[model samples]
Target: MDRPDHDRASAFDADSRRRVQVLVIGGGQAGLAAGYYLRRAGLDFAILDANPAPGGAWQHYWDSLRLFSPAEYSSLPGRPMPHQTGAPYPNARHVAAYLAAYEDRYHLPVHRPVHVTGIERSPDHLTIHTSADTWHAQAVVFATGSWQRPFVPAVPGRELFTGHQLHTTGYRRAADFAGQRVVVVGGGNSGAQIAADLTAVTETRWVTRRPPHFLPDSVDGRALFELATHQVRAHAAGDTHTGVASLGDIVATAPVRAARDSGLLAAHPMFDRLSPTGPVWTDGSTWDCDTIIWCTGFRPDLAATRALEDPRIHLLGYGNWTGPASATLVGVGRTARTAVEQIRTLLG
Candidate 1:
């Protein structure tokens, strides 16, 4: 239920801050999963998302990005991702649409346009401060994902480089660099995909710390999720010898497949340094590049949570730290369920 914007002020004055039993920070995949379990448990929880609307981080992914998993594998706890006829693997738009509907289907009490800035802990509870409102929560969860905090390596001469430089956060399209030379840094799928995208329009170089590990062409994220799950179960049972591919290994999407067919998947080892123009390879050679795109991945956005001393607050959907691959849509359900149960016990 929504109050009029005019009435919201009276609804949430400092002394009248709405208190929730639990507060889930972030409304992305992990946050939604947490909301699902929290609702089923009948917990008085509210999810706060910074995004203006649904779709979480998907809304910000590159235009050509696609999930490596099928619809059935990319769904939330109770809802299956609506199947798209042509997109065997859904793209960013498809995911954003599904998330918007999922929020409605369950009527998850997700508050959007609510950007959490920090948290303050008191003897009995936590106070979550956001851009618009302040929330007093008995228990808090940190599901704020990593995309907001992209990682850029500190290569030598980084400051002196005069060429265009950007992290994947700002990269929009290959056409943006149509006639220029592009250097894509990172060994992961993002690097490979972006490199592939740029190949259509520009001269490209891919530089990685090491040669990227590629999963079998037939294998995709679903298989990796299952493998990760099995590993988690095996670990619980004290079995040590488990082997399966991980998300870090690149999957050959259509563009990547085409790149491979055309012998454009070549990746050079990390350059020794950055020159004013481009990367200088360890071999003392340099490539002239007009732009450098760093797909170097992200760190968990736990800056605020890092200050918490309260065990009542939990963080979900940030890889094995919260649970296995907990950041991914399919992988978040278990973590969220487990976290809610822990919170339930703590509350008891």
Candidate 2:
């Protein structure tokens, strides 16, 4: 099989930072996908991941998180994400296990606990500085998925609110706020699902910049992915189409459906400003809130990449800065392949 196959061990100098043809940053799905293609092309490369374990940010997801897609649809390029015998949709931990196994199965030379500090460009090669050592490479691919950087928008009275404020990153379990009041902000899936989950234990209010759109209960992430694929293909072919779903639309998962049936899926426009007591509406009405769960999303963790002056540094998956599916697990494979081919062309 022409996959990210490995035949020999990674060769590094005694300093543990030796020069290779290419270096891949971030060992999450994106990085792993890049490794697959890079290996198939038989390039000498190494993958560096920051997490001490297999899962990148999957290890830190909220307790109740579930993939909107079933296991078959949620996998990386070569391997189908393994799952529990009866479980249709895999949880975060299941994904974590699959990723760990995928790395081992392919014998991908992944170095762990190597938190990248920065990147520097030299006349001959790019220098990757990590917590461990410095490495030299002729080319670099950035597959660093954007989970480390959580983004919360600026709002009035953000400093005035002394109440507990947490982004979705730090949110673990809903029971922590069992008796409290929460204002879950954002219109995306996380905001919808988290608001729904919080309703089981807390008095929750859902706030969004715009109306939250939900796909039919029969629809899930697979459909979204296919729709996206269609859109990309259509764009390539210069065709216009309609009646497909974007990934941003919420999926009516079991939890979400239950919440909707119980009248918990209602959404309100974003409040005027944040107050110590809660959020205040334009009419100056206030709710007694104790926490604002900002499911506000994240930005691309491209700080180090931006600092480089080289034109050869190509970045994958940090969200569509590259392509339609640049940031997605299933989508990054094609993006990686295209990137590697481009790198080969440049190297020639």
Query: Which of the numbered candidates is closest to the native, going by highest lDDT?
Result: 1
Steric clashes per prediction = 0, 0
Flag clash pairs in model 2: none
Q: What's the TM-score of every candidate structure?
A: 0.93, 0.92
Q: Model 2, clash count?
A: 0
State each model's CA lDDT, in order: 0.84, 0.82
Best by TM-score: 1
Lowest summed lDDT window (length 10), candidate 2 = 1-10
Worst 10 residues of 1 by lDDT: 1-10
lDDT of 1 by residue, 1-348 (tens): 223421232233556567999998888888889889999998998888878667889988899999999999988899899888898899998898888777777777777677787888788888888887888888998888998999998899888788999999998888889999999999888999999999989999988898888878878888888888899999899987765644447888888989977988788899989889888877889998999999999998887765556788888888776778787888899888999999998888
Candidate 2 accuracy as TM-score: 0.92
lDDT of 2 by residue, 1-348 (tens): 112332233333465557888899888888888888888888888898877677667878998989888888887888887766778888888887787778877788887667788887878888888887798888998877778889999999888897999999999999999999899999888999899989989999999999988888988878877877887888788776532544347888899989988888799999889887889989988887889999999988877775444656878887655877667667778888898888777677
